[model samples]
Target chain A: MPAGPTERPTIGVALKWVDLRPEVDPLTGAIHDDLHSFGCSEADRAALEWALRLAESWPGGDVDGERAEPPDVVVVTAGPAEADALVRDALAAGATRGVLVDVAPDAPSPEVAALLTGVLEGADLVCCGDYSVDRGSGSVPAFLAAGLGAVQALGLVHLEREPSGTLRVTRRLDHGRREVLAVQAPAVLSFEGASAELRRAGLAAVLSARDIAIDVVPAIAGRVARTQVTRRAPYRPRSRSLRPPAADLDVRGRVLSLTGALVERTPPRTIRADAAEAANLVIDQLRTWGYLE
Target chain B: MTEPRTPDFDVIVVGSGPAGASAALVLARAGKRVCLLERGPFPGSKNMYGGVVYGRILDTLIPRWWEEAPIQRWVTRRGTVIMTEQQSLTIDYRTTAWGEAPYNGATTFRPDFDSWLAGHATDAGAVLVTSTTATGLLRDGAGRVTGVRTDRPDGDLSASLVIACDGVNSFLAKEAGLYPHAVPENFTLGAKEVLALPRDEIDKRFGLTGHEGADFEIVGCTRGIAGGGFVYTNLDSIAVGVVLSVTQLATAKVRPEELIADLKRHPMVAPWVEGADLKEYSAHLIPEAGYDMMPTLAADGMLIAGDAAAMCLAAGIWLEGVNFAIGSGKAAGEAALEALVTGDVTAEGLAGYRSRLDDSFVLADHKRLRRVPELLMSERMQTQYPQLMCNLVEGMFTVTNPTPKKGVVALGWQELRRAKVKIRHLLRDLWTSVRTFG
Candidate 1:
């Protein structure tokens, strides 16, 4: 892809324009279709900030200690024409170029990935927000990584670039655990939405961005994924099968026995218990509450 | 000598309210590279106003602007009310002419109206950059304003001319030593609440039909706080508020909302605002001294318009600001154009702005009614006159069975004595009024 290491690289950033939040009418309880609330998603903004940081740090390729050209931070998105505001915002925030891929508003993640993969061919690195603010499916990065055959590091909470040209990132896992990884060039990394904030655009940049013509490319036919829902209902907890109490008793006694009202609750009491005894006590309470056999 | 730095824009208009938006609109339409800056997410997100927009100033700018401007309603009825705690007198007038096209005044939310006007500017090729505050003016070594320094990093924008329309608390004007009388005595605080009501309910309550509205200006309602009150109808809401003198309000130790509540509960105002739900509450500083507190209109490479220039016409019976802002802003834009053509953007070259305003209704109206704000806020006018007027009206209307009804002149003299208004003071005030409004 041009001369490697010596030539200027392109850092691609995937952007999504979405409404920050839905506002409900306080009096009527109806959602207002307010267009003013729509703008670039927070996650996408953070990813743009990360991409800009990378480009600034490696202004000239730092590889092999040779002075080379800096990378170009380009922001790309696939959406309707109104999404141009997102590109303009990114450019105002210091992105070198903007590309708006014209596509259907509801295009699936796989289709978007395929379209973006074709356009970002020469990019040495592609950065994206882990999930969009609206749908938040978080599948586009995975799909794009698969399409490009590039190393994928998704859901990164922390990121830094090493002097040796590799990117070190920390991905948050379940139960407060973290997974750290080092990724090389030709990689796709998706950062958590709250990881970083985008810098404010300068007035000169904001004004000049109005004149920068965004590259709008028509979408090519690609494999589109279809989704269907057969049935829909609000979620509810499953009911537990309870053992019934004998009916022959006083009204209060029968009610209390069936509800386990008196048997389950106890006033504040504490005791210095050994670890084994404490374990036994917890298990006994669990069994009494029918949580275990 | 070093070559002069090239300007990034021909004109930089700060604060995209009526004045800035109008200036940018005019400059852009004349094929000038203009930039309009706003400190909100959108042009009008941070703006609020009293109630109505008297848009005759916009006639030449956007011909028949009412058809598509996001107007809530056209005010068809106007009422001037005088009140004393329990007694009230109203002088109400209604006209159908205002309901028709090319109408007089309208009620609209500031956010929608300002954004709509800014949209016109942008549509006409003016670059509107929002969410950026112009922190200060950028001046050359010779003390000529060259541009503005914004809050954003590396946000210094250079321009040939700077038009300061940055509202009443304009720091730019203060920094330029333009506002000589900038003090609490020269400003008023306007606090308002937009109360939601059903559209049909509003129409029924206000005696209006089909995009018609009503506005009521009330006095003797601010509890002698040297201010007044207003209630106006929107399409689906009513804006009710008070304008209090900042200096008096400070020592009064009464929150503005308390005064608004008192007005709402008054016998005259209670019926109109019954069962209304507050949709929004806002407060803003108003430059109310009319022509007296107006700043120096033009400075080196800079011109002031709108509230920044104290262009608001706060005279009694004709409470307006937006129209004056638009008028002054248009004049500023025209003056800038002329200066650019002559290649002299200095204060002397921009002196046409002042003359143009003087020739137009903006300065003429302000100059004519320069003493109105002081006269209106005087102790006698704020407290005693309304009481005397209401008592005199009551004396005229009330039928006395055994006691013969007093003549109108005699009853007025009796009420004047009861209201403690000395004859000499009344005569002096009458003379002042004649000389002022003559």
Candidate 2:
């Protein structure tokens, strides 16, 4: 970690152009055209919001109730020309500057990671969404962490700066559990969907954002692909069994039949067993219902 | 005279509807630096219309526009349908000529059509700035309109000439003192629903094939309301709606949506739109004041066209506004070019815009059928006349074994008597219709 209370961290946010095409048409089962129109992903927006909140809340940045000198926030995205709008949206949402890396749409994850590592040279903290909405691969953050040789925290639900100038993060574990960890500066954080809500871009900010020039850098060459897919398949629907309606019966007859089917007439037997025996019985019943390991 | 300095742009046209886009296309093609401002996220995103485009104004702008643009269908059949509670009378006219090239009119969904026109304007070298609304007019030291102030930061834009193509309720025109705000009587509220159906089903039901379409003007379906109803066919959908006089609708107890619902459930209308799924419901305010409500067309460094100038003709038998807007917009562009060449953008310099409108059918048609609004809004035209017409048709068609079949004239006389209409009243309305419609 760097010296505490002496230096403010520079945060870099990774953004991506998320496709917004409807998955399927319910009425016709026909897929819609996947147009080139794209927008900033929701998870990326959350990460950007997290960075902004951290920078704004830094201590001693303001003097005598004047406007605070917030930490520098930079947004970076690597995609084709269509990603320019997404980068501009980050600028509108209060990012200090934006850097766009022009890369082919089908560039491998390692190439993207390498480009991001170059642009984020001096960034003390790097943040990105845990998974992209389009691919859902959840691998970019890991690749970036490996390339930068930085401490990586994936699926972070909460993040804040500690009093000692170290970074504190809370990772969301399965089954509604959370794990808190403290790490030094120059770390990479991938935020889950539970991160901070983003602030809206006002008209003034949007107009000013239009004037900001985005730095476009070309992609690097001589990158070997680590993975390739040879086959693709859409999600197959599971079969469902539906019981036939009792159309032959009248309303009263159907009601009686439904009541008889739903109600159990057997009486319950009282148990005079010990606590251990009762627990074993309950465990066995739960196992039969597939509710236990 | 002071020398004229070049502004940021040669011309700035506000609102990218038919008028603004048309003006931008012409000015940009003429090699003038043009900037088109639209408040919506895209051109025509905020626009809605009654689904008809008449005349060949678009053809002159974009030769054989239908081949490239997204036209719903060419209107080959048209009719006027008069309805009573249980009966209807129709006067229909169909022509094969209308379904071919150089067509008379076509149907369009405004969102697609307007955006395509704006695209052409951009292709001709116009800068289209969407989501930027002109908040107010910018004036120079001499009190002449010079530019516009938008809602964005540092969004002030200057131009040599400003064309206000804003729709019916034009805040810019009102701000410039060229015209007062329109009263309720000068406007109508139109509620429309676009119901989707299969292309083949729509063609089969409407008796159309290929790219042909139909337009039906309906009366007596409005429950005695002052305005009228309409049903227009598109390729795979139908636009069914009612236009009610704003003043009359305000006094009546029925809501506009309720009126449209009743029209959909009407015996004569329900069969035509059966089994169709509703796709969109929209309502818009139409300028119906005609020639009497037209505002001043030009001023110092400013020109107004389309609904902003009250250029819509809502006269019975001729409901048109888009063609008028296109025509007026073209004239504004040409007149502005003339004024620019002379280096005088004053009110006097732009006076040729008025002459151009006079030369075109926009002003002439409005001037000719200006009284149709009054006639259509009459109580008898809304209720008694349609009822009598439908009753006369039903009476002539109904036959009994014991009773003799009645002639058309005899059935008309008996229906007129039953509807409590005097012969003199009928003759006066007939004479008025002939004079106005002719």
Candidate 3:
């Protein structure tokens, strides 16, 4: 069926920023915690690029990890705070505008697709990674085409506007099958991972953007907040209901049996001391074992 | 009714710990604005104590608390053991006066006891906010203590008076300047471990019938440090711990965990707890330096109660302070009530708190027993004396082979003379103890 033309459309990207991880000085080994934690995500990363104008992150209450907060364009990548940072930088640099939202922990397929479809807003150009390292779920753009509304193009490498005022996009699919699509404006486009078209903001920008507060308005939902109940009582570990034939077994066998048979639910062990003591002991042990510098 | 999550009231007591929940009970019954704060997952969350309860002060507040409190057992027996280089000759007193209802002394897990007191305060209409901590104090202009600020967002609330009822090393008190300096060296730092055993085994081991418990007070097990050990019997567990001076500990270069571990490893101290699983372990500071470390009791708009006021006495014979804490809390509460009624919330208005304390057993005994900690820290008691007394007891009591020794003959007059301990010194120390403790 001579694969459908890849949709190349411009969508808004609102990049919200998160602070960089704190690092220690290598020479003196002194901890440097002075870096201010501004919830600023910049545009520019190792793996991905940001496109489209900024939009608000959906404050929608989460059902799974996916909140209904719409992303203007589904920018998928191997999860990196750097990628999120580039998206924010793109917004500040006036390249695109869209709120950067954390893909929820263990986000489900339907929710991610729905979130993308909502962002698609009928845009055909959706750019995204073919696959990712952290969460291999790369279905946001294609699934948005399937679920929300879009004609998705797989493995989009480049997205640009033509002199004739139409959008163009290129994709690779089906064992060296390369294709291009000329689509209209307002299309959903996802970029491939490692396509760093977005640039990192320099110090002057980071310091300025820090004062600009990004509001985190949680989307209110009535869904059950906690899916599991963990009751720690007397904080003492109890015997698991599943006993190994009430006898001896290898650790792997015990783990396998516990996972499979579900016979004895192993109770959580109680910690008799405070977190500091336990943490200090583990750190000390690691140092003693020559594991920690 | 799930307690219907009662209105956090004028006072929501967070902890049933002495200073905290005690304020709630005293003021609630008196009909004042108060709240008790506790961060224990429950009433006794993170609560543990050695079981030498001083009751005379407590009886005035709870009135027959020994009758109703969840005490493991009344202490009809007390065992004091002085160690030799190898063995210990012990002295025990089993007075029937202790076995009666309204026990003179009882062993308690602070969680249960503190919770019960919190409940009493609640019954008097103070709401208790469990699993909550007063992270900060709510203060106003001129540096007056107005209320407590908690860890929760928008957790700020106001009161006319904020009593620093928290506890030893109270963050709130220190922040409020109730205690500006670090707790001193004579302060007792106690670390306790609870070992669970079968109730039957516990009863047999402690030589108790059903519902009876024994407390063993120990000296010298602190490994030449200036502190002592205690073993209190519980329902199905044993509370064994050591209370020592932090300064002396630092001077001896003794790590507390090692000190406690060594204490548990002692031959005489181990059998009762041996093989029993350790359930809970915690450490707390007890105000023990006595007399000199007291902070100003009343501030512009606040009062210091419990350990905040440094009310503990580490006297050798009778070591106590919880009830004094409660009493001081009650006195503070009453003074607060009067201040609130009179619409006077200034430092001068709170002056009554100091006088109220002076009138009560809290300051009275603290002032009276000022010499106890001194006597306990005396150089003579730390050396020579305990050994001499233990040697005298052994000589008077021990027998060898077929020949039995008469008490006076076994005492060995020749050796006594050679020991260089004159009768005058004995007379002098007795006079000293009488003047100090009596």
lDDT for each candidate structure: 0.88, 0.83, 0.62
Name the better of 2 and 3 by DockQ: 2
TM-score head-to-head 1 vs 2, winner: 1
lDDT of 1: 0.88
Give the candidates in order of TM-score, highest first. Answer: 1, 2, 3
Note the DockQ of each predicted structure.
0.62, 0.19, 0.02
List chain A TM-scores, every candidate, in order: 0.75, 0.71, 0.44
Write candidate 2's Cα lDDT for B1-438 as tens digits: 222366768998999999999999999999999989899867898888885898598878888887887788999999888876677788899999999888888999787888889999999998777777988888887878887878766667788899999889888888888886567888998899998888998898889999999998888877787888899999988999999988788888789889878878888788778998888899999988798888898889999998889888888777888898888888898898898889899999999999999998889898888888888888888889888888777676677659878778878878888888888987888898888787
Roughly what TM-score does model 3 have, to 2 decimal places?
0.58
TM-score of chain A of 3: 0.44
True contacts kept of each: 0.89, 0.11, 0.00
Tens digits of per-residue lDDT for model 1, A1-293: 42377778889999976667665566555555445667767788889999998888874535587768888888999888888888998999999999999997667788889989887876888999999876579999998888877889998887788977888989999999999999987889998878999999877688789889899989886456557555655445699776776777788888887788869656766867999999998899899989989
Docking class of 1: medium
- Locate the minimum summed-lDDT window of 10 residues in model 3 chain B: B1-10
Q: Stretches of candidate 2 above 4 Å error?
A: A1-24, A33-38, A41-284, A287-293, B1-7
How well does model 2 score by local distance difference test?
Answer: 0.83
The candidate that wins on lDDT is: 1
What's each prediction's TM-score? 0.85, 0.80, 0.58
